[model samples]
Target: MERKWTFLTSHLTSLNASTRPLNGQTAIVTGASRGIGAAIAVGLARAGAHVVVNYRQNAEMAESVAAICRRHDVRVLTVQADVSNAADVSRLVETTSAHFGAPSILVNNAGVAHTGLLLDMTEEEWDSIMTANLKAPFLCTKAVLPHMIARQYGRIINLSSIWGLAGGSCEVAYSASKGGVIALTKALAKEMGLSGITVNAVAPGAIQTDMLGHLSDEDLAMLAEETPVGRLGTAEDVANAVQFLALPSSSFVTGQVLSPNGGYIT
Candidate 1:
């Protein structure tokens, strides 16, 4: 007999009270203007962490996410910076520190995806994808690590993908970049463990985000049917996982990749 899959909502009752688990902490979420990044920002705010919503080109959308976070009664700030650039990463970290002190949590959610056959991909395209999806994490983590190490406490969560674990056809660049993210998480976790910092990754599968806009109705329906849960994942599904990993109590967990894929790849 085939086993049935349970939706994430079915496990909601197992969660603890809505009380703040991250009070007085500050978190920085990169590329938080929309989609999964935006969801993670709001989720962190609701948990009582001051949030710095980082965006590269969409100021309006970044502010919109900030407004949602503000409604949670937690402090919210919006910053614009190209995470892949060293100077910009420095500016982002400095501004956050000036306003909210050094961040206790850094969510490297900023990333770009490209879907195409390797034969058709250009060098510029591959470079851009790698810089955004992989280099940004390295730069941001470097900028934040000093503060975290000094404080002896921090949470660094990288947004990875199912493709990182299992390669995707026609998405070679994207797969390789996310795979680098997973590798970075593991190495950094070990390096930072002695300093009381935990590093981890959240890999989402076929989420209902703007990223799926390119897919046709039939394509989406086919993907849903393929998933054992009979549905696609959600930004909130990934957000919930980030929230858990960000908690102070999760100190024992490190170098882990939590995939909210709805049984799509497991």
Candidate 2:
């Protein structure tokens, strides 16, 4: 038998307290195997959307996230795609469209980070960072846009970084890539506004994830002290902001960057 999943429009009417605003809509989260991407996928599922968890290589972790969503009695699909590759991105979007309907929400969360001084960084290292962080979102955005335009309803959220706004030493390439993401978000939002598609970016500060483990304890402490919140931000914190942006009520808010940085750059 062919598998069938609920589409967003029809699911809205059947929504209960457990599954509200997003009833029956489909959401695709890239790099959802862990960290912020995992959090966003789970958030969308809890909000009543069938979620597609896209991962590059971490199948086990991705499957775990999908199982968690399934426990909520919602459908979750796992897809593997290197978003920076055009062919993979094409297959990813096509599979998603076949499994669910045209995805109403697309979260461009796939990215790679590298820490090294400009002089020490090799050309290969720089290229990898740029391709994953910058090119990936561009390709994924292009892949989903056609469906969005046809439906005349869509939400696209790009994951940026606080460092993208305020450059960080030893992370020049990562910062540049995220900066490109912010610019992409703004420009695309303007171009697609007439089609009822809203595009935005979120810049997050120091968040509690495996990525933070690489930092020295003293560095982490300093970051906490610098933050007005006096603590590290959680993946949940960023996820919440994304949830709000993905809502239909946020239709009027587009082309803006929501920084969940706890006043770190202000």
Candidate 3:
């Protein structure tokens, strides 16, 4: 039998969404049209959060993700924005606020992945990777800080990469950006600790997502075998981590890199 995205499926239908952990809070999940981002959004919703599904493109897919969230009986909003663009991020947050008051949970999951040699990588490519992966986090974090600061409560979860810790051979730019994200997570956690906002990073190892579209079946199998768990991670696997970080129970867990890479790297 084939596996499916059970987190977003009727499996969650059995849970008591109203009494879930994040009830009544608002969460904004960027790049949530599909894959890990989508999973995180749905997971947050299932936890009873009013979710804003942020997507750069793919309006239809964003709506589909939103529709699933609604099944959990939580409020759902879909906003289209290029988070790397500060103006667009401004609108994204503003729209989320206009509808759901202020977002207490922010999952900075919007990122672009690149796998190529340093010699072959162009300046434009490097900039795009940095802009999307690094700058977007900076922009979104900056935009949401004021509201969170005033309320003295917030959860900021960044989606990093396993390569960010153990650099990938042909993935210089991507590794660099994700490394920056890890650094950002630690530093921001320190800065926000006094303000009741906890910042953390989730570095997922070889998840079975569209991000791995370039890899062949053999390559995926090899990666799975290499993983101690003997299988690749799932978007829900990472989403489960994000959900924990987003909860009030994780208030004391800050400035940490919660890598869900199945022990791919220690």
| Clashing residue pairs for model 1 | none
1-266, model 3: which lDDT tens digit per residue?
Answer: 23566665655654544359798999999999999999999999988999999998799999999999999999999999999998999999999999999989999999988888899989999999999999999999999999999999999999999999899999999999999999999999999989999999999999999999999999999999999999999999999999989988889999999999998888
lDDT of 3 at 231: 97
lDDT of 3 at 200: 97
lDDT of 1 by residue, 1-266 (tens): 12222544434423423477887799999999999999999999999899999999999999999999999888999999999999999999999999999999999999988888999999999999999999999999999999999999999999999999999999999999999999999999999989999999999999999988999999999999999999999999999999999999999999999999999988
**Every model's Cα RMSD, please?**
8.6, 5.7, 7.8
Query: Candidate 2, which segments miss by more than 4 Å at Cα?
Result: 1-19
The TM-score obtained by model 1 is: 0.93
Instruction: Determine the backbone clash count of candidate 1.
Output: 0
Residue pairs that clash (backbone atoms under 3 angstroms), model 3: none
Order of models, best lDDT first: 1, 3, 2
Score each candidate by Cα lDDT.
0.95, 0.91, 0.94
lDDT by residue for model 2 over 44-138, one digit each (tens)? 88888899999999999999999988876678999999899999999999999999988999999999888888999999999999999999999
